[model samples]
Target: MKVKCKSKSAFVQPIGCMMLSIISGMGISPLVLAVPRQVSLHSPEQSAQRQPQKIAQASGTDTPQRSQLIQQANALYSQGDFKGAEENLRQFTKKFPEDAFGHFQLGNVLFQQKKSEEAISAYREAIRLKPKYALAYNASGMVYASQSRWEEAITEYKKALEINPNYGEALTNFALAMWQTNKKDEALSSLEKALNIFKTQNRGEKVNQVERILKEIKTADEPGVS
Candidate 1:
């Protein structure tokens, strides 16, 4: 995505304005409400090192046991049993501390539990275990963004993008950070690029979200009568 942003603190525009306006123009529900607070919904990318957690291809007798544990953990996660997932991931990591995937899964669980600092640390460990793990960098960037550390977030996102330029999640998230930091032009370019990429990729609800924001920005840019 090619969301460009400007580096100025000029009044950052609200994205929902345009979205609501567009919906109104379409003769849909004429609801009037304050804009919702923006939150990053994209989960950080999965670390390549941790990719084996769900599907371990290692040649070992313990593989089956490890896989079964991961499956159970996933089931728990899907069932909103975050505590159970956390326990499972913790035990798995203890047994396979050297496994980058284990660290990554633990980080994911910690993040879900709102343990931002711990999650970041776990993601860092995953990164250390596998320097080329693009997902770790992406996940770290997401944590940094949550902390409002735009520069750090940008750095992590860039690292992920470097590993894979087509990392759409990283691209869009980086754009959001840029927008938050008053990089309007850059943000727009990045958002546009993200929109284009998602049009072809099965990005699910993200496509609608980006489009909504883009529309709001466009409306916010319109010259309103004083």
Candidate 2:
């Protein structure tokens, strides 16, 4: 998950590079292109576990048909068929506009295609549908981050953290945006918090990765280190 720091402008490495391993275990395929890692999408298994209840609540009836549609989209996404996934998700959202997950999935697919603006719109739609959608906020922040919109990214990440303080992914992303904005101390603090969360979650690999980044930051901050 570790990538050598290339330049100040590239603070966050490709999302795929950082999260590929984790996503693989969750039955999701990692993006092959080298785009800055933005947001983590729910794995197919996670989506399946949660979607039924969410669909029932939002649609007032969770039909087998709706579940099948979602599964089809998820299958396309897992197979790296972004176009198919997008089409299916678009249909799903149009039919169930209140389903935040559908919008979120659409955003993820658009992002994978490098349609930043469209992706942001989709993420925003998801958030509008579900104001407390922390993952959508995190995903939006990542798009901003990729565009080097550090301040906006920070704001979005903060909103996500407000909704879910222990959101490790958001905390990690927040730290990266903070560092890019030259808030070195704040970035270090956030990374420490993220590290602790990962450790508590028993994500040993992530803990190690964050520790490496933290060490690099501290070392670079030392006098004459550069």
Candidate 3:
């Protein structure tokens, strides 16, 4: 959210981890293995902005046709064809307007293309369709954070945590928004919680990143540290 005391690069994640780790609930399968495999699924909160693409896997009740469409979209998304994925998801949403996952994927594609407003709209629709959709709420916060809308981002992250208290990505991002708002102590507290979540999940990469941020935050608070 906001920064100070240091260069702020010590723990900055690539594009906010976009962690999409909350991506867990969506049904990601091996069909879209196009993403450069990073780490195996550990747990949520690992990150939201820095996460790799996670397309939805079909549910047991899903029609094969629908699953195929989602698979195709995932492939496009993994391949970095945001527009192509966008078009595919648009088609999917049009056909299944009530499907929260469809709108959710559409929102992800929009976010990648830098269409922040549109992405928010998609996420909102997903939430509307599935009020308990924590991932949609988290993704919405990411869009707000991307635009430096800290207050809004924090609100959405709070909503996500309410739905899923263990959401690590939301916790990390909520920390960023807190720091931006000058709630330094609250920010530190949030990051500490997030770090613990990653540690419990055995996500080494996320644990390392959160540790780096925690150290920097502590250093910044030291007497004479500029």
The numbered model that scores best in TM-score is 2
Model 3 accuracy (lDDT, Cα): 0.67
What tens-digit string does per-residue lDDT give for candidate 2 at 1-226?
A: 1122334444543333333233222111122211112223343322322542454456664466667777788678778888998898889888878777777778878977778899999989988877877777887887776666779989999998898787777787788777667788898899899788777777676687777777766776567665
lDDT for residue 57 in candidate 2, whole number 0-100 = 57
> lDDT for every model?
0.62, 0.67, 0.67
Q: Model 1, range 112-176, lDDT digits (tens) per residue? A: 67687998899899888778677777777766765557789889988988987766666777776
Model 1 / residue 123 / CA error / Å: 0.5
lDDT accuracy of residue 8 in candidate 1: 34
Q: Who is ahead in lDDT, 1 or 2?
A: 2
Quote the positional error of residue 48 for candidate 1 in Å. Answer: 7.4
TM-score of each: 0.73, 0.76, 0.76
Cα miss at 80, model 3 (Å)? 0.6
Alpha-carbon shift of residue 10 in model 2 (angstroms): 13
Error of 3 at 126 (Å): 0.4
State, as a TM-score between 0 and 1, how close model 3 is to the true structure: 0.76
